[model samples]
Target: MFNGIVDVCWIPFAGFISFLIILSAINKSVGVRKAYVNILLRIFEYGRASIESASKENTQSVRENVTSDQNASVQPVKDVDANESTNGATLITRDAVLLPQAQESGNDKPQTLKKEEFNFDFENCLDYVKSGVEAIIEDDVTSRFEAEELKSWNMLTRTNRHYEFISWKITLIWMFGFAVRYSILMPLRVLVCFIGVVWLTVCTAAVGNLKDGNKKRAIVNNVLGQCFGVLSSAISAVITYHNEDNRPSSGICVANHTSPIDVLVLMCDTNYSLIGQRHGGFLGVLQRALARASPHIWFERGEAKDRLIVAERLKQHVSDPNNPPILIFPEGTCINNTSVMQFKKGSFEVGGVIYPVAIKYDPRFGDAFWNSSKYSMMQYLYMMMTSWAIVCDVWYLPPMYRQDGESAIDFANRVKGVIAKQGGLVDLVWDGQLKRMKPKKEWKEIQQVEFANRLKSD
Candidate 1:
């Protein structure tokens, strides 16, 4: 009886895998993923409405109790005239302190400073307190490392708002979602991902045996793209590419990094030689497989001469026009897909056509960011598999070249600004590495110097 049940269950799983393979081979979708996303949106909408109604009722009850308590405990203050005096002291109205407007509205004038005794007032410290509070409310660096705040809960408990237990209706919906994600979706996704990786390894190994030529390169590119497509579908990735004409053919392709899947997303459409530190386990398998078929630069993590080796290899790769572009994320770390952070200048120093690609993931569907400090790779993949879907947009901007008299840092910032603007992301000057390390001593010193200068000026 158990054997018969297993056979029956395996039928649909095998059929699903076959369907995914067909989709990957054709490099097209029949709107199945789109339809799935629409269904998820409708479910989220229902949950949001149910949670809002419950919350409104709860808030109304609390407000009523608070209003009665305030009425019982408080007394009204006596009214006082703003301009009236008491005990020989005159009270000034706010209007009395107003200054007259300047007659020359179109012209600018410097204000004359009235020198007075410099007093150390607590009010000056209040500015610091306000800034501190603002930082606490929402900080640039820390918030970029956390999961994005959802306007409505996406039936996931891994968010700030806990609306799963808001109502019996929502609770039942959440339980159903949990069952679907854990019992059905995750296992299928894991199976598909495993098969995709195995397929990639086998195909790339066969392609690697071919003699070095254009034909071999062509075969490698096609195989890698198809394999990446299968892997992306494992997560139900719905990526829309913009400006396919600007897709990177050669030179270096630099993009803002949000997750390791960023490579998988882009590789589904175009093939690029990846460059990064070599790793072990799951990523190691993919890296080794990719390097066998293509000229990817994977260096040892703590090699003494890694930088020079990478620089030399990078120049040699770009010098050959026939070779694929080396994909790079010059930010050096992943960020929550809300902002573009300071990019490292090393990649920009290389003289070649720089292809800037912007990737923006719709967090409403699923958060694509990998907070490396908080979650391990396996844990993150688990979260991704259980999420509703991965929906994102990739914008390939026009190729850029370093202008005359522009430094590498300036060139990098220019590229970062363009990406941030195109993707509607906040352009931040803070380094992404701040997630892993403390701010540099020089950075703190610079702020200290600025504070001292302000004090002197005052």
Candidate 2:
């Protein structure tokens, strides 16, 4: 009976999946995903209310059991006058305050110089101690590298706040969610992703052989973007793109780096020539496939000469009116989606219209930040695949030009500020590479010099 059920249903199941893939590849939705998302939102609301109610109940019970047993101890007061009388002594105090001396009425000679003095105060060190402690507890740079904390539980085990066992209803709901995500959603998503990748490879390979022309470029862009859209659906990505009118036609496009999928997310909407270090494995396959039909710059991982080559290639690509805009993450590293870190000045120095794009991911659905230090590319992809969904907002800001007197660093910062503001992300001046590197000696020296000046002023 089981074999018969599987045999009868498998073919239809495969056919249905194939149909969904076609719809995704064509960038068409039947509102099924929208409806599914709505259902999930309702469930999330119910779970949030349940968790809050359970939390209140637990707090009340805890308070009831928490007895106010803090004992108060008092000591008898002694009379200062009585003690003074007993000792037969009178206390005399003198005012230690110093007043500025008045200038002599008619003296031509300058008053004797008073030597300046410096006294070390232990209290002055307390501020540094407090700052150190605060940094240890929660520093800006370190916190930006970690997973963002959610206000409420999202019903995922990875983000567990022990809310599942708070009540029987919540526990049951969690179990159901677990089964749905792992047993149903994950397998289906994997199958869809596999099909999308295979389709991209075959499609790009055929298109690569065609002569490079306007029609060929147009077809390649559509095919590549649509293929990415299909892959995005594998993770149930619900992307809301804003200000599409400002989308880049050509030149340099900059954005905050979060996850590898940031590329996929943006590419789903439009094609761009990607820039990054070449890799092996799953990413390598995708890179090779993309390079077949598009103009992407993938350099060796640790090549010293790659920078000059990349810069030259960048200039040549942007100079051409025919090529797609070069998409560059000027941050040079992935930062947790909570903040936008320092933008490298290299891309800004290239001298072209800077198209700033902002991407903000909804952590309640899933964490989109890829902590490369903690997880490998494959490991991160697995987490994304198992996640509930990838929901993000992309904003395309108006093209900005470098001011006449603006240096590349200032130009980069100006662009970074715009992206951060649009994305509702913290604007940080710290380099994102600080995640793996120690603080620069110059940075520490600057702080030290500031501290010395502060001490002198005090």
Candidate 3:
């Protein structure tokens, strides 16, 4: 009797439980469907933003801005072919990228010139102007470096010039300083090492601390750049420097990046911080450690992070009165020091008193330039001992503040032009002492060289 009673009541109760489970399942499915729809909406919004940014890349917009420069005189393009223009049958001087016209020969152009001889307005305007940079020394204008001023040695002289790094006088001074800091004096070697460890730790944090998302742990990496310049100075008697108004506060700083010493050289002037990068191995770990202790920032390259965060952080630091100006090598990579490399964009973005620096090495230690490519820390140090001194010029451009609607590329071009004039590297910076680098032609040259080299025999 008890079993029969239990079966009758439990069956109805079990039906109610089953009904509740089905209802809950239906609710979850609806919730998931709504969440997916929300995701799609967000994706659609991002696509809209992408389309808007792409619109800015159109040439029509750039041409419009190009047309409005009122200060320039109108120069007519002589003998331009009508077929190459958008107006079809009419030559559009502005539409064609500016190139120097072939000079007229005695045999050409028999007709006498009339003021309206050509119908087209000649935009003698250049798409990219390559001139040596003008050097500034704190409003105490020293002269500008002319491209003609730089006379190249089919090679720079590196004769039997011997160098003595540690003079007996300096040696004694170092000994005294070392003696004062000896472990015997304070037993602080362990503590100093620990401090280094802590400094490294802080360096790692600093890498990511100020970066906008795309930045690598680059602070330590940048600070380390100073080592190369210093090494160059160690070998050569040329000591080059330029002042930069890095932050908007007091001023900015810019210098020629001849070696790792590029950063060190700037540090000599002010206690500025660096932007660096982080690696994945032991070296990276070591760099990360350095970042943790220092006021450096490390960011991984290609990391999908918002760089605006880092930019804002730096902006705040620069705004503060206590911080020194920010310093950066506009030429992102180290060069052979004969000429300047193409300026990268970030250095131009920070709004402040803008200064352009032109750095060159003296013929002191060209081999140090060699070690710049293949040497590790130990190798670099060894190379430094054997060779590496520099003769360099530091040219500072006038300070600048960010204008409305400026792009990094434009700033790079402008600043590059300034530095080229200042440093006398127009010929050397791009292809070395032959012809100046054309702004648009530079990429084309690389492409052409690659294409031509691809078919070469082994």
Candidate 4:
């Protein structure tokens, strides 16, 4: 009975299934059928309107040409008659009799000129139409190109700075690289890491909450650190850590800002009390989960009072031996791994031992910079997963205390200098938030000069 049913319906069913799958894939990348239909309708309307406009212009030009031709022919005839009548009495020779005919022949020259002018106008109209059509076609092409580029996994992938133009062969190789990384390894790694993270976070939180002693909390912290180590290993194809022994056991740890993975890399080695802004969306979920596992200070950056509270909390966290060392990215925002932006003074003002950690990545593997404004969390993760590998170098410098009379701003800059030096990154004086809103051209040069002058004076 089953065999008979399969023979009767299998072919059609298979075709229908294939059609549905294709439609689903298209919808996933380019939105639903209705959106595409609307886009097609818009294109059709624009083309029709352009055609109508061109036709109207052509018709108007034709009518003008016909009117001009009649005028040219009639005016020449009238001029010939007038000249012949005016000169009739004065002219008696054969040459004189043929003068009107000669004048009429000369009038043909003006008619020829009028016809040439009409032809020129018609050509101009045709050129106008051609330009309009070309513009429309270019716009369509550009929109389609952008749509396809967005569909690709490498939307925010940075171009290699060393090489501007890449060959087709190289492009094909990268395409294959993306296919293998995203299609196969990425999903498996995500599933395994996510499960490990959830289990570890929940257990750590439960144990820390239920147990009353500092020893148990410390143990949980170690386990959480190990979990991150496993995660980093799972996601990164190749990772190398330097000066791991230099990591501070306690007090404040400040690092240069780069990717979201910077925190993961730091956590993999050290048990630190994180101090950062309270984030929303999927990031907020991770923040909340980690906050449960440990006493991480998540503050609302928009609230002035909250900022003050965060400073006090940092001070308190660092002073407590039972708590993990406090970790903060003093830059407050991620810059392109090319430079270290000015550090915020809040973390530095806590007035304690500061451990500066420098982080740098080899772009030959993959870029670790998180372009948050351009990409969502999932998109960023996909980019990371699809790359060849994420390779990083971590440098831990000696701890520094505030100089006897040094201000918070000066202290922050000094720390930023150390990190930037160790990481082999350019030191920038512009505030990250300001740079984001205005742009580099507006303030970068002026700020750099001012920073240089300040440095020279000091």
Candidate 5:
């Protein structure tokens, strides 16, 4: 009975994988392939837009309510002035200084008015009125704009439901398909990857023993790394170069980080020296091996003193032409490919032209992101192996130079903006360390304060 059930499950799983392979082949041309992918991506885009619209509406509604409440609170003051005028009594200004209006008396001379001063919160009242008017105008404009956008996308929402249902069904089939594929291919893939790593380690160790110069060893290591990348099925890289001449021989290279495979993708293309925090577990072994083969910089991220030392070392490395270009992920941590976080200013402060690289992955076939916090290195590798393929796009943008009076922070932000724009990623103002823990409001405020202080000290 179990064998019969297993056979039944495998039938649809096998069929789905076959279907994907056929689709992939049909869309082989880059232009056709991108258009086809965009068709599938429309559903996700519409869903995201709807969510944003709803959020904006909610915020506007809250502002309107607050404005109304403030107006209600102020209405009584206006009523008091109206009542005084109707009764022909002394008019009291907001400051409580009474101004007596002239009244006809039996005598022609007007009676002297008593100078009674009342202390009303006139400044507070004016402030409330000004804020209420601004809020009302802003809320009305935003609400109208969001409503128009939502109306334009009405047809998309209707059409998206049909495709979304189909996507869900495909997703279910993909889950089963991957499970069966992993069962069959995981062991072999592991063995192949292990052998590849061991081969590189042995070759690197040999070079170190021979006392070859660092530059020579680094070039050889990079060639080997490319071979390993291909063996691991990182088969295709769609690169867009902004300025070919901007590829510097020795300077800092900053890139938006996505996955561990990023190292392989980059090393396959250029002989760049990497700088990162020390890793542990299986990855740590690879890091230690690579360190022997090249003069890469690695430091403990949590240590303030270690960071200062790293800054000095980076400056020294960039000064030497014999050294390869030093690569740094200035975001300090990997983020989901949808967004790029704030860039750390240490690399920007090195005071040289910096090259920015933008990387994006196509999730239509397989997701290339390695969520290291949730999955171990081995698990992530297995996942990658079981997927259909890993496809990526890398853009090497023009080198950016700091302006005459620009601070390092401003320079970093300018570079980050260009990279984010080219990469089709949202630019976020979040600190990468937010990934480690959920921050409370107090924590966020404290972090901002610390960042401000650090800037001042710099």
Candidate 6:
């Protein structure tokens, strides 16, 4: 599996192999291939220099802050100016004495404007060092890449036939590989599931926790779920009806989270209660709006009583024939589509059909960390923008019936194993014994017959 993987992944690796074969055929040395990697090396150098510069700037800022703190009681060293504060100048500390607002009646100290402190003095020093050391050591890489692209595109647009023949062949290599690998081969089937994440976080449809008891946006909610799933997936998502008329009746829906987009994928047009974290500041307002529109909510998993109240409310949604299924994440925690995590036991408690869905991210944002990590949302956004390879896989298992004695934990485990198997996270890919989930019913029924025969003999 890994062998087939390396061959299909990334242009540089594929290009290297092609170059080597041609050289070997003509008995030429492989050293000429080194010229192609200069761009990559230059990029690495630029990234390293940027990081080093940022660290030095931060260290200097911190030292200045600490020094100011030590002399907090001393006389004001410099006149305060608004714009200077943002550029590593002295700042208003919490302990500083504040003058009353100018809006207050009878206050008349006029504001004074100070001469600008030139940024060029500091910037020139950095640039001089960069040009003398960094630039000399490395080509002006960013500009070089831009220039190269311009040259390549300019060459491609030329009408000359000889150049056109070679250009067409070169273009085909990159496009054909990207199309077949990302579209036809692996094709980011799971990336289709990214919409569910967005739904939970950023859809305008949410409106926030419902106050109207029921204002009627069920169909719209469900439609958005399917639409976002389709839009986010790149391949349009189709919502198949579970009941006779291609309409999904009451059931429990479970999914994985990779990004805020998942929310849009899961809740679009569905007349059901969507649940989310209770405490994210503005979420309270949004939840209130959704509450007014429908009965969706803000849930704090840590609060047992609040959750029980929410769970009871969920039962009402499931009981209502007009409302759609309760969509949920069986795994309470988010996970990178790596190894499947243990499923949370919330949905099976709702009873009725348990819709088991296996969510896997695709190439685009598939490696997205779902587990708890210290990374900021801003950082995740930065990576998502530059990398541009996130895909999600959603495999919906047939709705299951919950038996009277069966616990939610058992049902969740069964679903988790099926999802794990279907998503290809475990087994032949990882070279480990796959943890077995519940066996297929057909296999179980056949196995039971043999077990009964053995018991009869005993």
Best by TM-score: 2
Q: TM-score for all predictions?
A: 0.85, 0.86, 0.41, 0.59, 0.58, 0.42
Q: After superposition, how far is residue 388 of candidate 6 from its true place, in Å?
A: 1.3
lDDT of each: 0.80, 0.81, 0.42, 0.60, 0.59, 0.44
lDDT of 2 by residue, 1-458 (tens): 99999999999998988898888888998888778778877877888777766666766655555533433433333322211211111122212111112222223333232345666676756666666665565565777887877655778878775878878988998899889888989999988889889989999999999999899989998999789988988899999999999999999999999998999999998989988888899999999999999888888867625567778888998999899999999988888788898887889888979999999998878889898999998889889988889998999999999999887888888999999999988887778888899876555554565455445533
Question: For model 1, what is the C-alpha lDDT against the true structure?
Answer: 0.80
Model 1, span 1-458: residue lDDT tens = 99999999989978977987779766878888999999998998887777767767776676678778786644433333222322111122122111122222224333433455555655545545565665565464677787765666788888644678778888898899889989988988898888899999998999999999899889988888889988987899999999999998899999999999899999999899888888898899999999889888877878525667778888988998878999999999998887888887878888979999999998877788898888899998998998889999999999999999988888998999999999988787788888888876555544454434344435
- Which lDDT tens digits does candidate 3 get at residues 165-201? 1234334433453354342222322333233334445
lDDT of 5 by residue, 1-458 (tens): 99999999989976854443333323232353345445435644554455445556666676678778776442211111111211111122232111122222213432333344544444535543554565454432112111111112112222123322333444454445446446755544555556557766776676556555765756565545544543343222333334556665678888988778777767756667878778897778777777766678877867545656888888888887777788888887677666677788889888888988888776543556666677777777765776544567778888889999988877888999998899887665556655665544544344344333333321
Q: How many residue pairs collide in each prediction?
A: 0, 0, 87, 0, 0, 65
**Model 4 over residues 56-173: C-alpha lDDT tens digits?**
6666676678778776432211112111221101121111110111111212321111112211234424433554455454432112111121111221235322111133443454
Q: Which structure is stronger by lDDT: 2 or 4?
A: 2
TM-score between model 4 and native? 0.59
lDDT at residue 120 of model 5 (Cα atoms): 48
Per-residue lDDT tens digits for candidate 6, residues 1-458, read 98777767866755754454334323344443233234333533443344345556666676678778896544334422211212111122221111112111123333333444423334324433444464344422212111111111111121112322233443454355336444542333333223333443444445443333234354345434443434333322222222233224466776554445354334432444577767453346445545544556566756545657867877877887656566676555444344455455666677777665555554322234422344455454333333323434455566667677767666766776666776654211110111223333443344344333333321
Determine which window of 10 residues in candidate 6 has minimal summed lDDT. Answer: 144-153
- On TM-score, who's better, 1 or 2? 2
Error of 6 at 257 (Å): 4.1
| Candidate 3 residue-pair clash tally | 87
